[model samples]
Target chain A: MMQEIILGDYDLIPDTIPSEGELHLRVKPIDMVTYWRRCGAVANFIANFYRNPQDEIYHLNENLISTTFNELIENAAKYSTKRDSDIDISLKLYNTILKMEVENICSQKHMEAFQKSMEKIIDSDNDELDNFYLNKIEAKHAGDKDSGIGLLMLKKDYSLQLSAKITPIEGEVYRVSVHAYYNMSVE
Target chain B: MELKAGESILKYNSADQTVTIEGSMRLANLMEYDKVSVFLNDAATQASDKLTLDMTKLNFLNSSGITTLSMFILATKKRQNPKLNILGTALFAWQEKSLKNFNKLWNEVEISIQ
Candidate 1:
């Protein structure tokens, strides 16, 4: 049986990043104006963190770190309440697996749009998923679509396992947390 | 042609037909990325023979960023297709995987990894 989404306490991350196996970062009440800038900085930090400690993971894939980290943060911010809400992001490495989590506040309208996209991902097989991504790219390139392609690439290109939870915190306000896992050894 | 957005720099050298992308590019969405492809596609059509994109220092690229490159590659099927070349580094895992996808999308695209 498939486990349900976890909407419990999502604030268990410590204040600082660990030396060898974990890293965490948080920026609350962010606005769209500065969202891209912030995600770039944190992605570089996480990518370098695992890459610098070469003893922990041989030949660290910094691009993987950057791609995965940025994609999640960007999506979180897009749906986020921008100016007045918190957006939390974290990364942890254990036994050749790197896990990333992002929690951000979003609106009911954004929640519905995002959930529809996620359903396509969860329902498709590898082949179906690939076609869906390519079609999205083509449509977007031709100026006919605005569907975000980050999460699709997260799974197809990076082989990440993605799971998300959207829960209402108040009227018209919701909290969305997406957890992604990347198996470094498999690649 | 050159596009400088904060730390990111996208320089297209018309004389040498090269597009060099350095720093991180995390644009707002695919729409933003389409502008990049439009710029590249325009450059490709004007190229007399060939075009090269150097991503050696481009450490971060969201899917939208890579999608822009793929769109550029697919554009080669057009009548005025220029011989496309991509130069990237292998140390960056994203480049290592993402760069190869270009050839898979359009096999004739020339790629060099250092």
Candidate 2:
């Protein structure tokens, strides 16, 4: 699966496998605007796929999924160096946990920033997350915001276990794959 | 003033001092948010006593758009003119969680989610 899709060729084709409690789709958005729209479409699909009468978070599920997916897609599109590179996205469901991974080629600077944000979010407690988020919002008021805005919200607001992995694809070029894990029921 | 494209709409009624935003808002970039800020600033200047934003139908708002909106609210809060009131009719789960954060910007900023 990896060799055929990632190593050989990926032509913006979306793939899916229907499971008792799982669904997967993939897309390589052409540009920033398309990426944003694609994320919404994927999020909407996942939310509805999991919609059920017995679920307590029916109303909140779709929004949360879409928002979190948007953040990931936005980050992938914003930091990627290879606009032509494939933005390989996959969604997997294991019971109530929904995991999303978006892999794309990015500049070294983008990799560094992702690593830094992951560290801060990992080390900070809930109270610190609250204070830090408010501080960033205040910075927005000052027109001095940073890339950590979306990163922080993924952990603090959406309660996603966010992490980043960087593999050297070539000189000064890195394949950065961002992973987000969410407990749909916990929300 | 009104701006609509695709599934999004941002309308400002100078007479009632109300701004209604619907559908998704992922404006081209922060530069576009600056244009939105200018529109809101002008609308605020003409407001009678308050500015109410109906965002129930607004589905998705990217990080940049969120920041732009926070800046808008903060600027209005500083003016101390039209009272900042947000009618968050957002039924989406994200809106309920995200919109509440705006109250943290200004204690005086009233947010009613119906």
Candidate 3:
């Protein structure tokens, strides 16, 4: 049976936008680890693409966009189920709004984990989200690697609206699409 | 002691009891960050009075790196030894926003964003 799960402000993701700039990148999960610099490289490239010299917030926005993109791409690569499957990334800019989408193949285990994390973020108010983030950091054990702090930081620190769409593909595999919307105008 | 990978540098100077991190750090996973974690832990332990982390030049740190720093702070808090001070640069928006979270983990942590 095929199942679909949508979390967060999925409706806010536009069907189409007349983007001023667009970039698409695809990479395999295994290669991401082998060449870790690719994440930062691609992120800087995207930030430079949208750079405006006249804008007073140029440096800040550049750093912000690059950091934001790096986290999203890194998470997609880290959580992907198939090491050889490609993680697809798409970035579009509509005026001052930046839209990013990363799609990756995930096992049932990862899909559920991703869903649970997204639900936690979507359900929390400002104070609850802040506390949850702090608790997650404090709760880290030596063996535990990721606690979904990057996504939470995006929500809590950057005020980014994040969403995810999970669709079962076959057997225990699924396609997970993570979407993020950032308004560049905000200081 | 120092660890250099790609464009990033993590160096600890025992003389001043300061650890300086520069450039972008997007290490693969927690295991990859172990060396950094160990270096920080050692620095925190060795400092006589105050241990400072000079992150003013560190333009980028991935979430795993952040976790490593947080864990170090938490451990230092538990030990109740060498006071912690983080020197951050205002050039990076992330520093302005995320570095403050360290104080939340340990209120006594002194953070200066210049």
Candidate 4:
């Protein structure tokens, strides 16, 4: 599969897939913006991998795709400043939903706060998310830039199932992955 | 304008009566403009009663930027202190499209497209 969509230095095209039907993207920070600009490259690669005989196309809304992926890269750039720190985006189709996961190397302390923010955003309903967004804005007045609202906005806007996991890499490097499930079955 | 530097490249522009912000406000670091937010708290500030924003260079703004811009406009109306004039100059065709797309969410704000 590697030979099919050979991975490039900056981006990996649909290049072949693994036996488990997972598509991997070896993404760089600079290519992150272009990666987002070309929406559905992730989901499309997955759909092709799973090869659903139904010939399904995951038509992710432009706005939703742009917002979620932008957040992913923004966080990647925010955290991955150290050597060999890069963002890894993986796509897996579990059931009817397409799972989009973005992992980056960041400070361990920031991971705890990032996880807490994800949990709060995942648990929040529309009204709760709205209130949280507004409260964060108000907090800005007190010199508190609650960056968590970016995660909350994803929850409020797309209403996707979101989560994060922290993994320790070689040489004491840390990895934080944020995942969001998009329902490809939606009409 | 009150320009406060964010962690790195991010800058928050508050009310400053003297300086003038020309051209489009582009959050050059990230493709998503939403990461940038504008806050207008006090009723009596040096900022424009009716502010004119030049979107000549603003390519794309994310949800956060949109929400923040909306709040700035809301604050302008709620306080009713001065007319918050929102204006944009589209440098590229896409800029015009973005302003049009975002303009819908900002019905409450008095905005003009140039």
What docking grade applies to model 1? medium
Q: In model 4, which residue pairs have backbone atoms overlapping below 3 Å? A: A5-A15, A5-A16, B34-B62, B34-B65, B49-B83, B50-B83, B50-B85, B51-B85
lDDT of 1 by residue, B21-76 (tens): 99877777666765677777777877888889889998777776777777677667
lDDT of each: 0.74, 0.71, 0.84, 0.51
Across residues A63-132, which tens digit of lDDT does each residue of candidate 4 receive? 3444466566566755564635566777665545566677787665665567667667767787777667
Provide the lDDT at B111 for model 3.
99
Reproduced native contacts, each prediction: 0.72, 0.51, 0.67, 0.12
Residue A129, candidate 3: how far off, in angstroms?
1.8
Q: Model 2: per-residue lDDT, tens digit, B59-101?
A: 8777777777788878877888788888876477667777777
Top candidate by lDDT: 3
> Which RMSD values do the candidates have, in order?
4.4, 6.1, 1.9, 10.5
**Top candidate (TM-score):** 3
* DockQ score for model 1: 0.61
Interface RMSD in angstroms for candidate 3: 1.3
Model 1 misplacement above 4 A: A1-22, A29-32, A50-59, B30-35
Q: Taking the candidates in order, what DockQ does each have?
A: 0.61, 0.46, 0.73, 0.13
lDDT, model 3, position A153? 86
- Model 3's DockQ score: 0.73
Model 4 residue B3 lDDT?
41
TM-scores of the models, in the given order?
Answer: 0.83, 0.84, 0.94, 0.57
**Clashing residue pair totals per candidate (backbone < 3 A):** 1, 0, 0, 8
